[model samples]
Target chain A: EDQVTQSPEALRLQEGESSSLNCSYTVSGLRGLFWYRQDPGKGPEFLFTLYSAGEEKEKERLKATLTKKESFLHITAPKPEDSATYLCAVSRGGRSNDYKLSFGAGTTVTVRA
Target chain B: GAGVSQSPRYKVAKRGQDVALRCDPISGHVSLFWYQQALGQGPEFLTYFQNEAQLDKSGLPSDRFFAERPEGSVSTLKIQRTQQEDSAVYLCASSFATGGNTIYFGEGSWLTVV
Candidate 1:
């Protein structure tokens, strides 16, 4: 069974404080891993997609790195506006469609000024 | 439209009532999808559509949950005999015709079964 587990269900960080969220996975084979940020009462916004191990992607103050067994999302000097629930998802490499993402429970990060 | 749009941003239904949630995919997006997200949980896949063709409905929890995309651009998810367990946010998403394209999602339709 393919599963995704995110640690530290909720995190509180001070403004300008840096932190890292973890996303661990177990799957038969991996096609892609995706990261999304979702705000309250809204759908998730795409952040990054890593297709292979040892790959990384960055956007603004956020950087995502992937490995064979886990992934990490590093936030650098986050602001209040950056607070949101971060989701991790994976697509199976076999016959599973690329869009059929299996998501984790998500990690909620709150940044206080 | 500029992005995927959903109707009835919030809906409240009584037990045993049927509710229909609508989704309008982005213009020219060939693939559309429906997901159910419970509070505090990530969205779960409910169904997938490709140009009016219902290719996948395996993730649907029960037979009472039905989805259709008759025109390929607009999709609807109808829940029959609503139950409290059926209450969740219904999210609609769309993607391009091919490859690993980014699946864009709508604001979602919040359903509360009382």
Candidate 2:
């Protein structure tokens, strides 16, 4: 079965603190890995998509790196506005549909001023 | 719509009552998806539609859950005989193409079954 797991269910950091969130997955054939940020009462917003192992993408203060079995979302100088639930998802290729994403239980982050 | 939109942002239903949730995808989006999200948990896929055709309903928990996208633009998810276990947020998402990976989501509809 394909599964995705995120470590450190929650994290607290002061403004300007940098940290990384881990997401590990087990899939039949890796196709793509995605990162999203969700705020309360709203749907998730896309951050980045990594297609292959050793691939990386960056946006603003966030960076996403992918490997065969895991992905990391690194935040640099995070601010309170950046506090939100970070989610990681993966898609399986080959005979399986690549459009459907299996997501991990998100890691909630709280950045204090 | 500028983005995906779900109607009835909040709903309270009796245990045996039926409820219908609606989703309007972004204009010209070819793919639509439905997901159920429990509090503190990630969203779980419920169904998928490409245009007006229902492609996958494997993620639906039971037969009582039905979804349809008759016109390939707007969709509805109907739950028959709601149960306490059905209490969660129903999310709707759409993407530019049926086979593309990127999807955009709407603010979910919160359902409370009592």
DockQ score of the complex predicted as candidate 2: 0.67
Per-residue alpha-carbon lDDT of model 2 for B9-61, expressed as tens digits? Answer: 99999999999999999998998999999999998999989899998899999
Flag clash pairs in model 1. none
Q: What does the lDDT read for residue B60 in candidate 2?
A: 97
CAPRI tier for the interface of model 1: medium
lDDT tens per residue, model 1, A53-104:
9999999999999999999999999999999999998887765466688899
Task: List pairs with backbone clashes in candidate 2.
Answer: none
lDDT of 1 by residue, B1-114 (tens): 999999999999999999999999999999999999999999999999999999899999999999999988889999999999999999999988534578888999999999
Off by over 4 Å in 1: none
The candidates' interface RMSDs, in order, read 1.5, 1.7
Local lDDT at A47 for model 2? 88
Question: Per-residue CA lDDT of candidate 2, range A1-61, in tens?
Answer: 7899998999999999999999999998887788989999899888888888999898999
